[model samples]
Target: MTDQAIIKTGGKQYRVAVGDKLRIEKLTADVGANVDFAEVLFVGAGADARIGTPLVEGAKVNAVVRSHGRGKKLIVYKFRRRKNYRRKNGHRQPYTEVEITGISA
Candidate 1:
């Protein structure tokens, strides 16, 4: 009966609530596809909260994939003083945008 929950995906954890939109690690799901996050760590808040030892059993959060995109590029610069060793690189992490539809706990 809670409105908020914590979910784990792609080695990361996110706090979400119904109708929330989030960008997370890339998934294979296409746009408008349904995705379920079963690794719920906690649900609810205050006195009504439920905390799982590792993951809550029978708890899940449903979402719909809205889009797929990459995050802003990050500059990775490596340099060594007096060693003439310098490297510059850029990275853009792929992510999936999803909207939380419902949470069952």
Candidate 2:
């Protein structure tokens, strides 16, 4: 069995394996650029598993930035009953799509 790792990025943690694709907080890399994640919290599984005290030394997850885009828009409405006050807002969070290529620990 291959190793799976939990990597932290953009203030969030994600469990990943090779070839897995996910949308995460927008990164500064250009499309098709290689990115390396060094904050690996956990790696492997079963008897070979290793856990990090904050982070596992010499562990890393490699990926390629696929695309950057914003998510679906969300509408937020606020109103004050009987006060004739209302506000409506729309939001779309930006994110980057990435494909995990390799992991080393």
Candidate 3:
């Protein structure tokens, strides 16, 4: 059986395995904290397996918080061709990086 699994976090789903590094939306966990996600929307072994109606019970994804940081800054600009209206702005999104330790099904 494969050790890979699909789990949901921060309103998004990710396919992960042990030792995989992934970046998701901003999480409240501090660095070196352990986080477990129990909401498993899908589970499979090889090419065939069981699927949950909503979520599979007893499924979990364990991970460790590696770091907290901000993503690349994005510039937002708006201009009007005929009018003299212009606007420019920059935004940096907060994010968290985590390492998958284990996935159980």
Candidate 4:
């Protein structure tokens, strides 16, 4: 067992510890559903740690999906000088809220 772990999801990596809350890319899970992150890149604490070449075998990070929602809106604007062309757009990225429950290696 380790005190912290590095897990990969949604093309990103996050270093997490137990009871940590984080927002991640949208997941296909309902609120309060248990989720397991199997793509663990590293696990350990202090001087004892295990790093995987890509992913650690038999390493998993357990978490619970707390909620799903959209992030803050972002505005995108485009303009062409002397062309009278203008464009504006807004976007909100979907995300899932999760809490780290446990990490097993």
RMSD from true fold, candidate 1: 1.4
| Tens-digit lDDT track of model 4 for 45-88 | 87878899988889999999999999999999999999999999
Query: After superposition, which runs of candidate 1 have C-alpha atoms over 4 Å from their true positions?
Result: none
Better of 1 and 4 by TM-score: 4
For each candidate, what is the lDDT? 0.95, 0.97, 0.88, 0.95
Q: Report the alpha-carbon TM-score of model 2 versus the true structure.
A: 0.96
Model 3 Cα displacement at 61 (Å)?
A: 0.4
Residue-wise lDDT of candidate 2 within 45-72, one digit each (tens)? 7899999999999999999999999999
Worst 10 residues of 3 by lDDT: 43-52
- How high a TM-score does candidate 3 get? 0.89
* Regions more than 4 Å wrong, model 2: none
Report the candidate with higher TM-score, 2 versus 3: 2
lDDT of 3 at 73: 95
Candidate closest to the true structure, highest TM-score: 2
**RMSD values, in order shown:** 1.4, 0.8, 1.6, 1.5
Extract clashing residue pairs from model 2. Answer: none
